[model samples]
Target: MSFNNANGGRQLTDLLIIGAGPYGISLAAHAKAHCLTYTLLGYPMHFWKHQMPQNMFIRTHPDSVYLSDPHESFTLLRFAAESGIDLPVPLPRPLFVDYATWFAARTGVRFTPEHVLQLSRTADGYEAVTEGGGVYTARHAVIATGLQHYSYIPDTYDGLPPGLVSHTFALTDFRPFAGKQVAVIGSGQSAWEAAALLHMAGSDAELIYRRDAANYREGQSGSELIQLGETFFDLPLEQKREKQVQPPGSAAAFLRPYVEGKIRETGNAVVQKAEAVDGGKLRLELSNGETRLFDHLVSASGYRIDIGRVPFLEQRLLELLEREDDGNGRYPKLDAHFMSSLPGLYIAGPLASYSHGPAFRFIAGVRKACRSIIPRIVRSMAHARSGSS
Candidate 1:
């Protein structure tokens, strides 16, 4: 619950983890099992609690939505059974949040409920300053921050006034837009679902996307991509790329029927650009050469994993970190062990997807990430201690 330095100075640990979302909690479970001294900082499942809509359902199947526990006893399904909760496939968000909390408690991964304000390198390892003036020092730091901060608001609407436009990730509810003319941009699941929620809330909702139609995962029984088992990560880079051919943000097959029938009943219409208009409204320039206005606009365009947007990293340390082949801040260039160019610093979760491939993007991927990286980290720490002694 708390890891404060009683002496009002830096509390030293072997590992410091930021963000207690699914990835952070999974990594904390692994660190606990390894007997590594670590301090995890962040509210558990903060994004799910505050950002996602209250009635949302996860796209991942029940079987895949689990945090990695070395003992393998605690799982979403198991938690549901033990708690006498009936679980429907494509689990509900509330149930998953409860399951995550149960798993964190069951795994004994204590998290310090604080935000990391800044992270900088130190002579020994790294230093993290928290919101409450608490400083933590560790031999290494692992960033498990999820997609919350990376929400993508396209440049097309960048100059718009703040109240006129926003990302779907920023809104937890759509009730405020009731009776208002709202425009939901993008053809992805988020866009479709947001439109549906807006409609349910009594808003006049319209959808816009560049694509001719909304893309959804096809329901194919025993598909190779879905059946990717424990050894999937060991495949060649080309093989991984083959599986990642599916573009991001496409709706899951399980929700396709509902979304298509209820939300995007009509196919997508092209939107060339969007501009802010008077009275806190937005003007959409359609590819069909017509302009329309809406009282509010929500971009469900998805997130861009630009590392530069991460505000906590010190400038000097940020410059030292390597970037992906594109040499863009969109992704970090990580080594085989998921360590960045800077030694003893690791990147996990969706951020690791660029290097580790598609599997790193969701809760399903956390097990593989932890299984692969934890042992390496333990070994490196051991070696460091021996060398110093």
Candidate 2:
């Protein structure tokens, strides 16, 4: 999908999607069903790019987590039909990825393997450039790049240099840290997985958290937040008008007490709570005032919505991506459908998680995600077509 050089009013494609994960695939299938002109460009299931280690099970039930189709054709159950693996049950990670590849091939979805450097609006719509010598344009663009790209690596470790510190997402194994002291920050799965791999690889590790143990639970905290919002935050007037847009409650909940708990359970790991990283060290400046140093620090702190960090967003659009509050660094204010303040721009997956409710990060969210935005795209398409190109 190359740029349309001619003067533009209503650009080329009716829709163009970036980051071809499950979110992008679902949208492509939706577009096809609606007979809309759209193109999906990116590595399909790119989130799986960082290969999961040797023996980790999929956190979700395979029956519930589907890739492209709404039902029947591309279901994981169908893939299991051949392998003799049980359907409606969780399958191994390797099998899940293989199913996604098979689904993509069968559906004729174009999965371009490229790293997008930036996304900016052209007169025609949006133009995306790659690190390689490739550029493309679309009338409307959707960002579904999953949650792995951006991370919440604290600046405290920025000056440490190289092997001494890293984000949890960047590491695959902890064998190199064997016999070395390493600190794993955050209470999520990424943090847990890092610590587990470290222990398996024979590293001395401690998993630290900023929250109390009471806050941890099985299932998501969103259920509690949603109920609490009804009494405090969600006003009758707002509920009457459907003001229940997403605003961050529980992310990474399914991983339990989270990935951190599992790692902490490992014999080689210690649980350090109410502490945060101060400079290059873990400073326990809470109910327990202790300080310790480690040879390496891994931040599994997750991500924050910083429009400024987004490569594709232009400066003007960046301003629009910020929430109304005094720049705590959120995203462009969006509709329930994940449509940005800018016209003809939509977002899916992690970037729109705050506005799309707790399920935005999972495959289970696909049906609702596609439903919310497709109608808007269809209506907008009529108007877009009447204009120019």
Candidate 3:
């Protein structure tokens, strides 16, 4: 049957996967190619919607970042090979966006491109509310927002002028800061890499964090399968409280060699350990009470799992979905199939690992997550068909 026949004028669908990042885009592309009658909605790469400078690169490796299609016709490696770019596979942000756009065009993956305002489940299916004033229905949903819905802004900096300070997530470009002085708060890969990029662009940059020194991720000597689950993904909620371990995503992923290269081994960038001082001027009072002047700042603080911020997450249903990040935060609890305890709902990406173990965060885990989820989705569709017949 033609896809339009299924779409028709009605908003009904077999499955509705939210947030069209790599994970969502991959899932949607696969479901449609399999003729599963699914509707994949949400903005396509909304994270890339903002303006970022052309000089940045992705932290992850290249060959692994991929879609779920079985054809294997297009891969990051192939894209790079065809472009003659010959960069490492993790892919730059812009190239990844171009890949997604190409996939959407080739596979007919659809997106609303507007904010999903609300989600609710009725007896028959789920209702998704969008800012464009449209309501769409589907029997199931897989959330693959891939960090677009969350930001790590600090509360103390809330009242500060937007120009004086901003989250690393908010940074769009570093070009204007050429020859300008800048202080970056946070020691994770983000803070480190942002500092490196700024310096390369000719900005005088300083790195600051609460810790005395940077704890770069220890490079895995072997495949991620050998790494600690805690290093790859957080332990389950019950498991964390029992061991009293620090929650996942609380610290940056273990630093790899490639990532460490971005740090200033030279004196061009300064690393200071301190909590930032509050002031009206652009000068920063260091933890040691030393003050330094800066033209701009970037806070690579951290993120919270507040359901209130996720535009597409259902309020009452989210209350029903148990927190799995060892109860330290409100993350969804999923079974081995990546199905949320909510039933008919599935989760992928970093969120799943806190419950299923460390595989949720890796490129390897993304492949594994889909391997388990897709079969179950197909089985679910088959069962529904038999029941209707």
lDDT of 1 by residue, 299-363 (tens): 88788777888878888988898898744567888877789988889988888877776666666
Candidate 2, residue 251: the lDDT equals 27
Pairwise TM-score winner, candidates 1 and 3:
1
Q: Give the clashing pairs for model 2.
A: 10-388, 119-312, 192-259, 321-331, 321-332
Model-by-model lDDT, in order? 0.78, 0.61, 0.62
> Over all chains combined, what TM-score does candidate 3 have?
0.77
TM-score of each: 0.91, 0.75, 0.77
The whole-model C-alpha lDDT of candidate 3 against the native structure comes to 0.62
Q: Which one is best on lDDT?
A: 1
Badly placed stretches (over 4 Å) of model 2 are 1-11, 51-54, 68-73, 87-91, 155-158, 210-287, 291-293, 320-329, 383-389
Off by over 4 Å in 3: 1-9, 49-54, 71-73, 81-90, 105-108, 155-158, 176-179, 200-202, 210-280, 358-364
- For all predictions, the C-alpha RMSD in Å is 2.7, 6.3, 5.4
Task: Residues 1-389, candidate 3: write the lDDT tens digits.
Answer: 01222222345677877766667777777777677666666666766656343446555555446555657666766666766877643356788777667766666776656566777877766777777666767878787666545667766455556777777675777788798878777756667667766777788777766665556543332234423432333555565444333332212343343334553322223324323345544765554656676777787775554444666677787778776655456567777678887778888865765665544544445555656677788898899899999
lDDT measured at residue 276 in model 2 versus the true structure, 0 to 100: 36
CA error at residue 43 for candidate 3, angstroms: 2.6
Q: Which has the greatest TM-score?
A: 1
Ranking by TM-score: 1, 3, 2
- Which lDDT tens digits does candidate 2 get at residues 1-389? 12223222333667878877778877877776777776576766766645455444455655466765544477777777866766532245666777777776666565556667777888878876665545767777887767665667665554455656777664766678888888776655566666667877888787766544412334332333323322322245455235334342232344443244434432222334323355544432223455566777777766765555666666766765546242465655567666887777887775654555445655656666677677788888787668855
Clashing pairs in 1: none
In candidate 3, residue 300 scores what lDDT? 73
